[model samples]
Target chain A: MITLPDTASPLYEKVKDYILANIGTGRWGKDRKLPSENELVASLGVSRMTVHRALRELTSAGFLIRLQGVGTFIAPPRPQSTLIEINNIAAEIVERGNRHRSEVLVLETIMPTKELALSFEFPKRVSIYHSVVVNFENDLPVQLEERFVNPSLIPDYDKQDFSKTATYDYLMQKTPVTEVEHIISAIPADAETARHLGIDVGACCLFLHRRTWTGAVVATISKLTYAGSRYSLGSRYSPSKSS
Target chain B: MITLPDTASPLYEKVKDYILANIGTGRWGKDRKLPSENELVASLGVSRMTVHRALRELTSAGFLIRLQGVGTFIAPPRPQSTLIEINNIAAEIVERGNRHRSEVLVLETIMPTKELALSFEFPKRVSIYHSVVVNFENDLPVQLEERFVNPSLIPDYDKQDFSKTATYDYLMQKTPVTEVEHIISAIPADAETARHLGIDVGACCLFLHRRTWTGAVVATISKLTYAGSRYSLGSRYSPSKSS
Candidate 1:
């Protein structure tokens, strides 16, 4: 891609746009390496600083990754997932060969509030089991899961030791899940959650709110908050063969 | 909602969990103000520092948001949206009474690479119209959209000015979309993308990768990346109603 004309635009911007144009035009194919800084400066007729800034900027954006002493290369486009898959945090960490643990904070039955009654489609007077569990990966708190379960569905709920097993697994065995909803949000963690998650009091958390249905019974409603730095959500995309 | 004794644990953590329990169980309903710090200290029989820490942490975790002069209140639940409801960025910005513009970097019909061909479900030798557009919201770049369109479906695609009208709208009128697979990911913007989006070189980006099918012909493939600090992806969930 030709870059750095004697135009009014900044030299680096021109060079950066040129690189992007070539990449889009298949001039620099995916996973293919890019030219060195010196080569770029010479070819684009820009200063080393300009080329460096562009390359450095691109590397940070995930377009190109630069290894120390190694050449820079175009990153492979990520595959996006289609399924609305929401896995349990404890299960996910354990499956990744990491030690996972949880500290059970609260486990008791409470009367459903107006909102809960409406969301769960249950009578407002009914009692439900509420549990607050702070899950950790290798002793570092990653997710704070606060859940309310339909006590009627999970009989003898208070007898279960949740520190050893997730309510998700326990309820799955007790009743069949018919539906689920997953929600994600980013917001500042209050002082209490900051202490639990071991982050600054005002730092943000990525909150995942989930509600599961079991046949005619609403299984559980949970708000799982994760430290923004601790985890990332990923999905893959594949174009269909038929439109 | 009780704070049991566990002196060995961090005092703040113990207090915070107790408060979180009350909030989650609806003992502290949404928009309901919490007790003063002094009240909590007295009720929990904990040090002022411990109670303060707990409350401070809770406020940061999105469990509560503290207002100056006003007492702290429980946060409303996060909002959700329907699944993968694709909206045009330019149109959305315009609807908001903001000027929307785009710097068309590359717009050309080219033969897809082997992987690209497979992604678009076209013959290895087939050609596609590819475009790299930096869409601006009020002159501030917010989205970097890289897209591929099947030329066979829109043979005179070069005639359209995407800046004036989005490809999605144009395609929707020309072809009826039957199937779509959308993928979402949190990634760092590439150097080129960072420049276009006017964010830090390595800032996180929320990417929505989508593919649309229009009855046996793959319409297009798009990777829409948004600045994380400036944009968010949301969806709402409603319990399926049975007739």
Candidate 2:
């Protein structure tokens, strides 16, 4: 049973909003069975067509899962990466009710090459911290992160154990990022990235290159690769009124 | 030659920002040769290392394309699809300074199936306008747009010439959309889509499902597919203060 708002919206939209409110408030948990179309029609004093439309639209929006000949249930939550936010992989996995773990493959300080020096805007031949880590969700590798840290920003980078704390989490605590930029591309995985992610060579992957600035110096540059089949980046926001 | 800013930021960052500003303001056009490292160092009164770092970072960021023996030049712009904005494909190509064109494949009134009915939140068996248009960037197929429109909202949907005017552009002019939603996925292309987009079957494609609302009714539902090798969705915005 639900209450409908007396407003200018259409009858079906009111019905849809009522159902969405129930789901958002957690009254109807994930995978929980939803009321039958007839039950909703009868309880909400709406026609069968209106009730059916509401349920169908909800299902299409990823809020409900309909099983033919059985009943409709709430859809399970999927792991989502926010496109506009610099979020940590561990946090994203945990938010989806999954276990998150990591394996540190390479963590060492090295002399910056001309390219690396230019990327960080640091002098050439300077020492920089380089690391490669694979992040897993329920023991399945999801992301392979290759990161370079400016030694001037995080001098004690080698002292931390990355397996226990994600580089993003550690960096945020150590330095305040002033600006960030992301360049996204779909590229086939090379031999090294494929081996770490447990995917075949030349498989398509979502490659994300990120650079973060702290004050005036570039603090970190990272290449985050996700197996295209396993991960997707998403964002939802209202457009500005002017646009 | 670049002017140095009187700020607390590092010398190299100022140099990078100066170069970026010139590019952003269209003072230095695309593919235009940039000053050599020695010239920039002498003009900006900065060290050679500082000028080199600035040039290197700009190249990596896709602003400048560096040639080893030749001089550095402005990089050609890449086509970008905004993840948050409901943008038109024709406009995107034009924004990248490329010509845009389209070929209409399927355009007819279709009786809504059970799934399409649910998607549009309309009663089953109602007539809807369905269209398949392949968008091109200078004759290179980039996007295959398959769309379904609610006939009740746009009764004259079939009357427009879609090759001259995109469905998105037409819809925006016909009605004011109140809400928009996007769902992104990566999947292998089927035979039909492959043939249309000129890609091999089973090749990875970026699949985007979009729904737009006019008032309370879903005005349209669209599935826009892009060849993964040719197209990518991107966005860059400052995160809100609170995560």
DockQ of all predictions against the true structure, Cα-based: 0.06, 0.09
- RMSD (CA, Å), candidate 1 to true, equals 24.1
TM-score of chain A for the candidates in order shown: 0.62, 0.64
The residue-level lDDT of candidate 1 at B106 comes to 81
lDDT of 2 by residue, A211-232 (tens): 8887778999999898888887
The DockQ assigned to candidate 1 is: 0.06
**What class would a CAPRI assessor give candidate 1's docking?**
incorrect
Q: What TM-score results for chain B in every one of the models?
A: 0.62, 0.63
Candidate No. with top lDDT: 2
lDDT of candidate 1?
0.71
lDDT of each: 0.71, 0.78
The digit string of per-residue lDDT tens for model 1 on B1-243 reads 345676787777777777777875778775488888878878888778778667766664556778878787887642221132235676667877998888788889888889889888775577789988888877888888888988877777767888777765676556545566665555566798888888876566666677777666688898888877776554333333311
